[model samples]
Target: MARFSEKKIVAGSLITLGVLFSIIAAFTDCSAGGADNYAHYNIARWAFHYPNLFLDHWGKPLFTILIAPFTQIGFFGARLFNILAGLTTAWICYLLASGWKLSKAWLAPVFVIFVPIYFILMFSGMTEILFSLVLMLAIFLFFYDRFVLSAVVISFIFLARSEGAIFLPIFLTALLFKRKYVAVPFLLTGFLLFSLIGQLYYYHNFWWLITKLPYVGGIGANYGRGSWYHFLEKAPDYIGILIFLFLILGMFVWLKKWFSSGLKLRSEIFTRLLIVAGCFWGYLAAHSYIWWVGEMSLGLTRVMAGVTPVAGLIALVGWSEMDKTIKSKIGKAIFLGLTILFIVLPGVLKYKSEFKADTREVVMDEVVKWLRESRNFDHRFVAHDPYFAFSSKVDAWDSRRIQYGFADFTKPELNIADSTLLIWDAHFSQNEGHIPQKEILDNPKFELVAYFEPKVPLKVLGGHDYCVLVFRKMENLNVDNNQLMIKLKDEQLKGNLVYSEFFDFEHAEPGKVPDQFVVQESDTFSNKCYVLGKDSEFSPSVLLTDSQLKISNEVSVGVEFDFLAEDQLGNNEVLMVFSVEKEDKPYFYQGQDVLAVDSAKWNHARYHFYMPEEVKKDTKVKLYIWDIQKKNLKIDNFRVQAYSK
Candidate 1:
């Protein structure tokens, strides 16, 4: 039999390099993932004091408990905790690879360390690395013939990420098929412990464990989903292109062999497929399904970091296949050289920004710093993305010191005390907080206190301009924004509509495209504009490219359209997108399901947006609709008007 252990030098070097990179990233890079990352750190930091926070479904219970001690020092401590977890994951990955007696198995650690998003996330306070570590370790334990321990560890997958429950079947099948009946009972170990703890918290009144599940809402449009192949499309961005390609190839080669070979449950290759590759692809497929169905999954590629070890393992398998397929020693050397060259250098470079400090967080840091130095501000602040809470050393759960309203602060149930300071950011506030800037601005009770624009104009993902704002609530003073808006509209309309046009379709022909609305001129002759609109990739769209608006000053634009869908809309939505882009990158972008109707009826929808400062005179702006389900529809009275801001 081939030796299972890797060379001591190879092991030490891989371990050392992984540790060094994680340490450097943890301290040096200020940005990681979004609010969830900071929120996880906060939960871990304070879970001991607020014992319920340990069971806080959003922050995985086991993750909180394990990481709590480390987080006492600061978020850096939690980051260090992840570093350990990540290193442990790499070690287990290396062990599994070498134990399988794969050639050049030292590449496993290298693969895990350099996976772009995994590299960044492993050093951050996010739960993905830890979650990945636990799953990977369970298999490692099983590999060592610790069947009961493996079952117990696999059960704890839920306490890391809720979706991890999906992997429970893999172990269940393995244990049952292997006739390890005792190990099968151990699968409930994690749930039972958490249940007891939750029972204590609930005073034994009800099943707090079930009630506390964050994703209990079966399937609804919480965060609208995307394509079924979303993960497949985005894997390269998460893992580097070399790993992504290798991962694909690994799945093909591994699955091909697994199916072709004997259908024995106790085979060695079955173990490899079920644990390593199974965890990776199974996760990818599950996430893809949720995202496709418009379930709770937001379709973030960062979630892939949780399965980084398995992904790296699969990629290594692919590398081994490449080795086996090429019999010539010289040819194998060249291929290995190419793999090393490509993986070491860069093929997926778009994700490089993820390694650096996110400009959004950097800009928010300035805002928080200013708030700290400028005046004596109350810790009782209202904000989305409890970033302020973390930075100010305020306990998020201590409502006495802080009025922290997460997600739905706009709702009346979430009462905000008078004279509260609010930090309304563009990113978290718009997406997770579900509050628009206009809502805050229009409210008479709140006054815009400060606005900090970055020194250099910058835009983050989703075209959110990097601008942090500060608002203060004053109950004593008030002004009628409704009256102000009416007056402003009157004043603007009295002047002139910068560019007002309406497509009534009365003069349009079925065979002819609308005037000045064709997206591609090459296909205009062949495409049909059914009455007045054509919406294929090669056809016409509602493009506001007229020079009339170009010469005008900054203005607020409102687009109202009448729509009638031929088919009922299910989870899909009639997405109307209003965007302003420069050089193909959007400067301002907003998509609304203006007509989310089940029946075929004429629905009048109004969507409004202000022209961002990023929009230049020569910049291209587009206003379009995306029928996600491709429901053929009739649109009429499509009108757009812009008035000076």
Candidate 2:
């Protein structure tokens, strides 16, 4: 009776946890996979209206079709679709664990739910969550002797993600070993079905599948490559160390089992080892090679989310092996408690660290609001960013409001309508769309109307300020491209000292950086401040210590400092950089050059910078003055004051 009661309690607990996660995820603006999430969601959101987008290659037709109905209601509805798939995947993991005769089968859901990257991707519109559910279901069916069904289901894998093509040969080899020739034909179901449906676009071209491939290009020269251990190193970051340790243990167990029988492919073992474990290792190896060779795609850790379900199984195997050793029931309970804590803690910490909404989204929202209020706000726009379209409520199907075009801006003479706004961003427009900024800058047909840049910058690697340049196609240019920046301000700037300090080194510790810097020095102060002499080994720099930099795009910060190049170099001026970095990623940058007016003289220079916004979202704001040019320079009585406009 106690065992039955425990089973009911466990089932009810899973249901409750799943519902809670769903509700929380719906409201959260956490990104699934950056720009790709919005790109995929936009396709799914509008595919119902156009119908042609159901066959869009870049959008991943299967993913678009699967989530389209939910997306029709809203992006939240689309999130719920992925969330439902996630919860169902957890249930499948539970079933797979129970079927494998694992002692702690109930821990399967817990393991799947807590995978750090997996948890994040499950709330997004990306194809990974559903792909995970589909692939895992295929594994379960294959193991249960539903050979034809498994093949039919696995056939749709490629439509979910381009990586699915890599699995076809391995799957075919497994089918051949098991002598399931009947199911072999069914493996092409997804390709054949989609191909037949895509005939309308292809104009009866049977070779449309090969011709319309989305990711068919060669290696990108600048996308960067990684070693084989790239994913291995980043594994702990995405899956957390607890799952990573167990994953290594699980792989060891599987490899041991595979080699114990001298590479034998027994029918019973083939399903689990050849297919299940094969998918796990196969997916990992392919990605490792793809990144290692610097090919088709860059090494994005989020791609691993697609195979997280299988990794969860391997993790479960590792946990099961460890669970077997604890003889005491009390010890086992304690172990279970710790496992949950370790798995969940990383995700919770990550959630707390990241902003509720990404800087890109925040800035894009502001840009859209600004655009709506501007002159000719209703004029047609040409933009590459999917988020901009979503924010502007521009129907991609209707090219009147906005044209989803690119590469057109590369031309010197654009044929766009007069007053049409070409909204270009530093991201998609520059990278994927190949819209060269220099061409637009040189083009006379385009007029720089409004420029939008974020205050708080994106903290991701290879991130940019997400500058949205609003240019109007004009016969006669109104504004100079060189002076596109127009600062908006009231008559009086708001006096708000987010932080202020003055350091003259009057009471300074010798050979140490200054602190607080509040001691104001009167005239006739000592000349004992920090200095960097000619050919000095170390650069004496001013670092704003423990300052909560909450400056925004509208905030104006005045920087003042006393400097002297006692023995000034031959035309080598000190380039002082007042940089603000978050997590070593320098996003907000404002700098100045201190050219010595006269040699051996202390020159006082003052400058004000309009800082970007919400820098407080970072772990730490490093506002420091550095001698980037490394010229012989002296600095003292440095002061920084911030005010809002």
Candidate 3:
């Protein structure tokens, strides 16, 4: 009894910590942006705009209701829901830990630290965390013999994430030990209620149901029966090194009892493992049956998230079966390793990365300032970073799309090209295939004006991208006195034929280097602007001459250029930039580091340049280089001054 009390204390602490950490992390930028994060944002936006429609479209009234309050606050609110769900999950895990009589010291932190997926999903602002929480609640209710509540919880769990349906039966099988026939009613009731809700919401939209059926099948195939070899390959990544080893030790301790014992949890354990194994098998089968390796990989990770608690619980129970001496030795080894990898490594790396990346508030401030100053308030923008779309009042969409058809299916007049802002993530571009930036930038209607590059290169830790770029339209069009002319000289070009390595200023032969003109990979980083011209034969220069002149008559010229020098050790040195002026008189204005050699996106060094407005009179302007030493800069274009009207 004392042991149970102490265990409860530890479980409660774990729950508390999970809630606290989630709240604190909410204030940090780690929870803001990602690809899957965009999906949730889409759902939330739908919820906010058309509540009834969202309920109908998603086939999950409970899940939609769960996020409605947060959806009112926009993306951040939805993120709060995830954090709360994560907390609920933590509490559920804590309860399991208490039931298993594990030390709180051993269990509390493991809710997040031991599993990379937990932290990643929690920080990424996706549905996985919420789904995990729901799954746990249903499992806990089922185990406690609360059949009706379990049915409702499981119904909602499926509503939250479709895979719940596949795993529900396996969970019900656990009850077969007490009353073999009792499982049927719970299964049928749960399925009927859930399906009835979905069907009613859709009004029996067979097409939609048919379309979604494949996803369920796909999930099962990926986790269930692809291949044992593939499982072995991905197991280490999904479970992590320390957790996998602990599971191995646990397997040894629980081997005999897991299969033959008549302990209180014997049937429950077998059923739980069967369900988990089924999920694993389903995922594998889906992968083997699919063509897109990328899509399979993504789905597999999500499936793994839903099953993490089961893995953790099983490993704990198994470890509990071991002798004190054996358990202590195993625990000590696992603890030491986990401390080094989960605690020390992640802490150090996150600190360094945070320092390297610009603060979220800083970037938000810049974005808002740019929008206000440019009067781009009502324009519909597509940002590579989903957070902007979620946070800003602008009509923003996710530019991280696999299919690139810009023509509006809803409105014939609208096209992808009509999007006013194409905010690109530099780091995402680097991982993607070559981007036809020149063609996009050279479009007569589309002009690249503003760009945001990071101060440091973004490194991929665990298959995630974290960098950004912002591009706005030009204000002028007529090649008035406010434009600048640039000549791409042969001597100024340097690079292999495959890709334009901007540093050397020398052109390579055709077909030798990778083309930077088009994006090959759907998820890779890329320039937001369109690329123009196929070869380096010096095509027509892009023009940006608008008549909204309020500044000095001096032509406000901006140019995108690249540099290739090596030893850049200096306090402040000129890196060569382009701008415009009417008279020799100076003017006051603002400028930014549009491109940097440090971008993870650039195949070589590059830079982008833009002028907010034509130079104004009495503007005391002095150019200052932000830093030096990065080579291979690519100058997109330079905007020059327009003659004052």
| Highest-scoring model, TM-score | 2
Compose the digit string of candidate 1's lDDT tens values, residues 255-304. Answer: 78778787556787777778677787789899999889877877888898
Show where candidate 2 strays beyond 4 Å.
Answer: 1-11, 200-203, 218-222, 259-262, 351-355, 458-464, 486-555, 558-624, 628-642
Q: Rate the local accuracy (lDDT) of all candidates.
A: 0.71, 0.71, 0.46
Stretches of candidate 3 off by over 4 Å are 1-4, 31-33, 56-63, 71-76, 100-113, 172-207, 212-238, 259-269, 276-303, 326-368, 382-385, 395-405, 408-439, 455-645
Per-model clash counts, in order, read 0, 5, 98
lDDT of 2 by residue, 189-260 (tens): 998988887775643666566787766554223365789878878888887788888877877776777777
By lDDT, the candidates rank as 2, 1, 3
Winner of 1 and 3 under TM-score: 1
Clashing pairs in 2: 455-612, 455-613, 456-613, 552-612, 552-613
- The residue pairs found clashing in candidate 1 are none
Tens digits of per-residue lDDT for model 3, 138-228 = 7767656776676566655665666566666565565554464544465555446645655676545424533454344331332233343
